[model samples]
Target: MRETAYWLINIACAIVILVLLGVHMGVMHLDAILARLVGTVPEPLAWENMVNRGKSTTQVVLYIVLLGTALFHGFYGLRTMLLEFFSSDRAARVITAGCVTAGGVLFVTGTAVTVVFALNGAG
Candidate 1:
């Protein structure tokens, strides 16, 4: 049951990633195109823009969800690949632990950065 749940979760995460990432890419590219049309190109990574985005509750939540799902999806994929390479259950368990640890650290860091941007009003 647990293994099945993991597979199902990964499938759900992948679907979510496809939809969310498409929207993300569209917004980023569209913003650049709109800026160009106005004869002014905005800096993509400007701290002010980032802070502004983070200031919006909806945008901040969306970013947090995207970050979490992407991290889990990518790390779970890595765990699966590592398991494939090692026939030993012990090795696979170790790999899973490592992946989980690394994913947790990265997720926390990403969330913290987002929160910092929101609180500081400047990145």
Candidate 2:
């Protein structure tokens, strides 16, 4: 049951990542394409834009969700790929451990950066 629950959670995360990342990319880059079509200058990708977006509670939360989902999907997918190359149970265990460690480090770093930007305000 526990293993099944965990697998379900990973599947949920993958679905969330797919949906949210699509929304994120559209929101972040659609303006450029729209501006071209409308014959206007698009918003510059500048520090001000970053700071503004980072300062938004909605954007911050969205980014946090994106980061978590992306990391889980990427690391979990990588672990599965790595496992396919190794036949030994011991090798699989080691690969899983390494994936978990790498994922944790990356997640922490990403979360810290998100928090810092959100807290620092316009920088």
Candidate 3:
């Protein structure tokens, strides 16, 4: 049951990653297309636009969410792959611990940076 829950969470994370990355690509990469469609800023990568996004609470939250979901999804998949190769209870425990720790650290750090940037007004 526990393993099933983890698997489901990992799948959900993948879906979140897909949706968030799609938004990211549309905003950051498809600048020309979006400009034509919506008369967006000439350069999505402009410093002014980046600063504006960084100062936006909604953008900060979305960035943190994307960071967390990507980290969790990647780490969980990696843990699964390593377990398949190791195939020992001890190895499984160690892999799980390492992945969890690393993922947690990355998530916290990313969230902090996002919050700080928003608080600082991205100047």
- TM-scores for every candidate against the unseen true structure: 0.81, 0.77, 0.92
Give candidate 2 misplaced runs (Cα > 4 Å).
1-3, 32-46
- Predicted structure 1, TM vs. truth: 0.81
- Residue 60's lDDT within candidate 2 is 81
RMSD of each: 3.4, 3.5, 1.4
Worst-scoring 10-residue span by lDDT in model 1: 36-45
Q: Comparing candidate 1 with candidate 3, which one achieves the higher lDDT?
A: 3
Residue 85 CA displacement from its true place in model 3, Å? 1.6
Tens-digit lDDT track of model 3 for 33-111? 8889988555777888898899888898899889988998899889989999998999999999999999999899889
Clashes of each: 0, 0, 0
lDDT (Cα, tens digit) per residue for candidate 1, span 13-104: 89988988886775566677767667675565677665677887887788888888898899989888888888598997899889889989
How do the residues 1-123 of candidate 2 rate in per-residue lDDT, one tens digit apiece? 954765787899989988987776665678777666667743647767767888888988888888888888788788778888995989988988898899889888998888888998755
Best by TM-score: 3
Clashing pairs in 2: none
C-alpha lDDT score of every prediction, in listed order? 0.81, 0.80, 0.88
Clashes, model 3: 0
TM-score of model 3 vs. true structure: 0.92
Positional deviation of 95 in candidate 1, in angstroms? Answer: 0.9
